[model samples]
Target: MPHAIKLYVRYVDAINRRIGRVVMYMIFAMMGILLYSSITKTFFLPSLWTLETAQFFMVGYFILGGAYSLQLGAHVRMDLLYGSWRDSTKAWVDLFTVLFLIFYLCILLYGGYSSTEYAIQYGERSYSSWRPYMAPIKIIMCIGIFLMLLQAIAEFFKDIAKLRGSEL
Candidate 1:
């Protein structure tokens, strides 16, 4: 592998790993928020913000951890034919399939960016009583999508390396 490709893979992996580690704690945050909400509802007036806040945390948790999930090969895959392939054959097939992933991620990222821009420009808010500003979550969505796109590209590179009898 070339130096630049290796460096790119290393940097992207490191970044996604760090971000994923941080995002993992969001589950606890969501749990805490729900616990508080349950307590409040049982003893006092229900809080409008707790449910929505917990949902937002969940969205962040899923989105932000995507790249790390991809890096770890945690995502599910169809394995009927894949299980029989040799490593290089797998890499070849992966290189071909990852193009579709890259294309899909690109489209998703573009849509996410446009949505985020509209949210920011219009100061969009949710319909709920709490009516939290939508831009923050939209921005996070775009960021997560962008990171996933980068990770997909990194995987493409890794596949190429594998085909070349090396690993990134």
Candidate 2:
């Protein structure tokens, strides 16, 4: 690989790793909040904000952790046919799949950006009693899609390296 490409890949790998760690910490924090909320609700009947907070954390967990899941190759895939393919065939299949995902995520990023912008402009709020600002969640959706795009690019290059018998 060229020096610049190698540097780019290294940078992406570092970001992915850091994000993965943050996701782990967020999961733990969410778990703790859920436990606390459950206890409070059971013993003291906590305010609606507790439930809303929990829901918000859950949403954040899923959206923010999506890229980390992809980095770990933990995303769902039907491998019934893919698992049986030869190395070269699998490489081509993976490359095509990555290309498709890139295009799909590009569309999502565009749409998400427009939606978030509109939401922010209108000052949208959640319908729940807490009425938290909805724009942040919409923004999170865009960030998640952007991260997925980055991961897709990394995976594409990794696969290409594998197919070419080069170390990534």
- The superposed Cα distance between candidate 2 and the true structure at residue 132, in angstroms, equals 0.5
lDDT of 2 at 91: 78
Least lDDT summed over 10 consecutive residues: which range in candidate 1?
159-168
Q: Evaluate all candidate structures by whole-model CA lDDT and list the values in order.
A: 0.96, 0.82
Give RMSD (Å) of candidate 2 vs. truth.
1.7
Q: Using TM-score as the measure, which candidate wins?
A: 1
lDDT of 1 by residue, 1-168 (tens): 889999999999999999999999999999999999999999999999999999999999999999999999899888999889899998999899889999999999889999999999999999999999999999999999999999999999999989888889
Instruction: List the RMSD of every prediction in angstroms.
Output: 0.9, 1.7
Evaluate model 2: give its TM-score: 0.89
Model 2 C-alpha lDDT per residue in residues 75-129, reported as the tens digit of each score: 9988899788898888788888999999998999999999999999999988988
Off by over 4 Å in 2: none
Off by over 4 Å in 1: none
List TM-score per model, in order.
Answer: 0.97, 0.89
Clashing pairs in 1: none
